[model samples]
Target: MANKRTPAASENDRLYGRALAVIRMRQGIPQQRAAERLGVTTQAWQNYEAGLRKSIFTVDGLSRLATALDVDPGLIEQVKGLLKEGVSEAWMSDGAQPLPTSGSEGKVVFFSRRAEPEVPPAEELAPVYGAVFAGKPGAIAFTPDRPDDWKPVHPNQRGYRDPFYLQVHGDSLSPRFEPGELAPAVRGVWPTRGQVCIIETHDGAMLLKYYERRDAQSVWVRELQPEPREFGVHLADIRAVHAVVGGAVS
Candidate 1:
C-alpha cells in the first residue's frame, strides 16, 4: 500500500515540483527558501522543483502554496502551460505548466492574495538560548534583544523570523505535540486560557502545557485538557512568557 501511494504521490510530486520552480524563478527567490516554506528538506525541495524527482502535490498542500505565492489556483496552471518540460516557474503551483492545452488559448495568471491561507501562518522560532529561559516576564533577567545564537531555520527564506516557532517537550500538551515532533510553536506573550504554552519549567524542563493566569503574579499550568484524558489540569507557575504557538487560524 505504501508503494502504491508513492507512485501516484510521485505524479503529484512532479507537477508540484514544476509549479514550485515556476513560482520561485519568477518571483526571484532561492530554492532553499521555498523549501522551508513547504516544510521540506532543502535538497528535496530543490530536486522536486528541478523536476529531478517526481511531482507530487496534495489539495491542501497546493492550497497552501497558492496562499504563499499570493495567487489564484488557475493562475498557476496557466503559467505552467507557458513553460516547457523540465522548465518550471518558481511562482507557479502545478509545476511546469503543459503548453496550451491542445488548441486552447492560455489565460494570464493575475497574482492575488484573495485565496485564504491554509494554516494560521508559518510558525515563528527563537533560539533555545535566547533571553532568559524564564516562562514569565517578571522572572526574566532583563535582556534587550534576542540571543546571539539565534538564526532562522530557513536563513535564506525572506521574513522567516516573523512567525513564532517553539520547541516542545513532554506529554503535557499531548495530542497537539509529541516528544519527537520538534514542535514548531509560534511566538506570543499573552496566551488565552487553555492554550498550550512553551516555557522553561522551574524544575528545569523546557515544556509546553495549557496555561492559566490566576492574577498578575500567580499562574497555573495544566495537562490533558480541551478534552478529558488520562490526566487533568494542575497548578503551575508563570515565569516568563515567550510566545503562543497554536489556535486561531485565519
Candidate 2:
C-alpha cells in the first residue's frame, strides 16, 4: 500500500489544488485543454482541481503548468497565498528557508535561496490616463490629475521621446488596439503613413487612428478593423499629432 501524506503536506496540497483550479477558471482554460498541455491525463488534472491528489510539482512541471495557463508562476504562488512578504524566492531548494504561513504564529518558510540572474531595473514610468476613445475626437487635456496610475516603459522603446500611456477605448481599432488596452504615445514625433497616431483637433478633441497621409490642406486617417473607413480633416482644424509607439493588453 502507498504511504499516506502527513497532515501538513495534505493541507498544502489542498491549498495548491484550490489555487490552481481558481486560476484555470479565471483564465478560461478548459480542464481537458490544460491537461493536454501539461501532458497529463484528463482525470489526473480533474483530481488536482478537485483536491483529490497531492500536488508535488517539480520546477519544470510548475513552469509548464504556468505556460499552459498563460500566467507567471509567481502569480500561482500569490493566488495560493504561499508567497510570504519579503520572500523573494518562490521556489523550494535544498537550502530552503522557512517563512511563516498565514494564520500561523510561528514561521513556516518553505522556499530556499538560489543563485539567480539579476534583473535590471525598469526605465522610466509614464502616467496612465483613463480610456481614450479612437472613434470620437476629444480634448487633449494633458494634466497630472491622477499621478498614482502609471506604467513603466523600457528606455529603448521606439520613438519614446516624452512618452505617456493612455488606455484605449472603442472598437475602431479592434484587435490592433482593443478597448481597455494601454498604449504608449510619444509627443513631438511626426508619424508616417500606415502608423497609428493620436491626433488633437483645434477644438481640443483627440482621437486615435492610422495616419494614411497628410497634405498641406488636410490629413487623412482610417480605421483598421470592424470596418475600414477613412476621414479627411482639414489642416486648419488640427492642433498636434502624437505617434503611438507601442501598446499592451491591460
Model 1 agreement with the true structure over 149-180: per-residue lDDT tens digits: 34333321122223344433334455666533
Worst 10 residues of 1 by lDDT: 95-104
Each candidate structure's count of clashing pairs: 47, 7
Segments of candidate 1 deviating more than 4 angstroms? 1-115, 118-164, 186-188, 201-204, 225-238, 247-250
**lDDT by residue for model 2 over 142-226, one digit each (tens)?**
4436643777762323223365777777668888898778777766445545667877776656778887755445678899766
> Any runs in candidate 2 off by more than 4 Å, and if so which?
1-120, 138-148, 154-159
- Candidate that would win on lDDT: 2
